[model samples]
Target: MELACAFLARNRMEEYELLRVFFDSKVVREGLSELQIPSPLGRDVGGFQEQWAGPLCLDGILAGLIVNGGAYKRYRGPARDAKVLAGAAVEALTQNRFEDFRVDVSHVAWAPWFANVAWDHTYILTDTANAEITVLCITDTD
Candidate 1:
C-alpha cells in the first residue's frame, strides 16, 4: 500500500505521459535489486542518522541507482539510460513530508527490506552507510 501510494503520488506530480506506463496495476511487476556488498561508504558528515517509511515509493529511483551503481555492470547507453533516469523524478517526489499534507495519508512499514527504510518528506532510503548491501527489493503492491 505504501509503495503504491509513493509511486502514484509522484506520477500525479510529474504528470508525464511515459510514467503512465507504470500506472496500471496489471502491468506492474515485482522487482527487487539485491544488495551489493562492500559498497563505498556514503559520508554522514556529522553523525547523520534516520529512518523514514510509510506510504513512500522510492522504487524507480532505487532501480536506477542500483542499475548504475559502480558495484555492478554499467547500464549501456541511451535506451537503458532513459529507463534508469525515470527513477530520479519519482525519487524527488518521495522527498516531501506527508505530515504537512493537511489531509489523511496513511502508510506502514509492511514487509521491510533489511527490516528498515528511511523516510523524510521525500524518499525512502535504506541505510547502507555503515555496512554491505547485497540486494534491493521491489515488488507488486497489494
Candidate 2:
C-alpha cells in the first residue's frame, strides 16, 4: 500500500480516499469478466487488456517520470528514492510467488466524481506461475 500512498502523495490526491481491494488469484484468472469488482466503464478486464499491444516495463515507467535538464532535475534525488521504495514494495509482493510476470498499464474514462476527469492509471501485474494478479490502480488527475 505504500506505493499507492506514494502515488497519491505525488499527485496531491489527499482529498480523496483510495480503495484497495484484494482478490483470490484463481478467481481473477478464471473468470475476470464475471468478477464483481467495479470497473470504470463497467467493462471487464479484457477492455484494459486491449489498450496495450505489449507489456509495459516497470523500470521504464519509473524512469520516464524523472524530471531531467531543468530546475526540477534536482528533484531527481527524491524521485530516485521514491522509485526504490516502489520497487521494494513490488519485490515484497511478488517475491517467492512469481516464476514469471508481466506489467501493463491502461486508462479508463470514468471516475467516481464529476470533478475527477480520468482513470489516470491502471497497472496490472500478472504472475504467470500460478496466475496471480496484482493490480495497482491510480485514478487521479495526472
Candidate 3:
C-alpha cells in the first residue's frame, strides 16, 4: 500500500487508477470468495454483489479528496477500524483543526474501494508544504 501511496503522491493518476482496479479485483475475487454457502437442491445463486457499508459523509469526503482535485494519496497502515479514523478526521476537519486542509464542497458518496472489507483501518495524510495528500489503509490479514 505504500507503493500505492507513493504513486499517488507523485500524482501518477493513471497508474493509480490501474492499481486501484487491480486491488479492487483482488478483493472481490479473494475476499468475497470466502463467503459461506449452504448447499441447496439444484439451486442457483445468482446476482451476487459486494458493497461497502458506510454512511454518505465519509464517502463524500473520500471522493472529494481523491477524485475531485484534492489529490489525496492512499497509504495502508495499522488501525483498529476505518470508522474510527474517518470519524476522527471528520471531527478534526469540522472543528478547523485538520492541519489547515479544507474539504472540497462537491458532494459524492460512492467509493467502492474504500468499502473493501479486506482493510480494517484507513488514514488520510496531507502535506501542506507540498500540497500532497496520502491515505493509509490498515488490515491484520495483509
Candidate 4:
C-alpha cells in the first residue's frame, strides 16, 4: 500500500529512476550483492550489520535526517514525507503486507547493507525472520 505509493510518488518527482523491488526469502542465502538490484553499486561485500532493521525501523541508515538529506533535496527527489517512505520500505523488506500500511517494526531484526552513501538512498535490506530482501536505489550522474 504505502510502500508502493512511496515508490510511485518518489519516481514522479525525479528525473532519475528509483529502483524499488521485493524479493523472495530464499534470495537471502545468496547475499546482499547478489540480489539482482540493477545499480552500479560497489563490489565490496560484508558491509552489513546485524542490528534492528534499518529501513523498516527508520533507524540507522534510514533515519529521517539521512533520508531527507541534501542528496535527496538536491536531486529533487520524492516530496513525500521521510517517515512515510521509510515505513513503506519496511513493508517491502519484511514482506509485511499489512492493510494499514505501517507496521510495528520495533522488534523486527534486520541486517542491511548500504551499497552507497546514506544520502544517496541505496541499500539492500534483509529480514532476519524470513530472510526476504528488498532494495531501494536512486542514482543521478549529473
Q: What's the C-alpha lDDT at position 57 in model 2?
A: 42
Question: lDDT (0-100) at residue 97 of candidate 4?
Answer: 39
Descending-TM-score candidate ranking? 2, 4, 3, 1
User: How much is the lDDT of residue 125 in candidate 2?
Assistant: 69
The number of the candidate with the highest lDDT is 2
Q: Kindly indicate the candidate among 2 and 3 with the higher TM-score.
A: 2
Q: How many clashes show up in model 2?
A: 0
Which has the greatest TM-score? 2
Give per-model TM-scores: 0.21, 0.46, 0.25, 0.35
Q: What are the RMSDs of all candidates, in order?
A: 16.1, 12.8, 15.1, 13.6
lDDT of 3 by residue, 1-142 (tens): 4454455456553434623342245443364343222222111122111112222255444443333221233434433344456566656544433443322221111233333333333443433334544334433322
Model 2 worst lDDT window (10 residues): 12-21
RMSD of 1: 16.1
**What digit string (tens of lDDT, one per residue) describes model 1 on residues 85-136?**
6555434433344232211111223233322332211223321222111112
Question: Model 3, clash count?
Answer: 7
Residue lDDT tens for model 2, 13-129: 223322222232344435543334444423233234422322334644544343232222334465667567556666765673433555545565333321233334566665554
lDDT of 1 at 30: 42
Q: What shift in Å separates residue 95 of candidate 1 from its native position after superposition?
A: 11
Q: State in Å the error of residue 102, model 2.
A: 2.1
Which one wins by lDDT: 2 or 4?
A: 2
Every candidate's lDDT: 0.31, 0.44, 0.36, 0.38
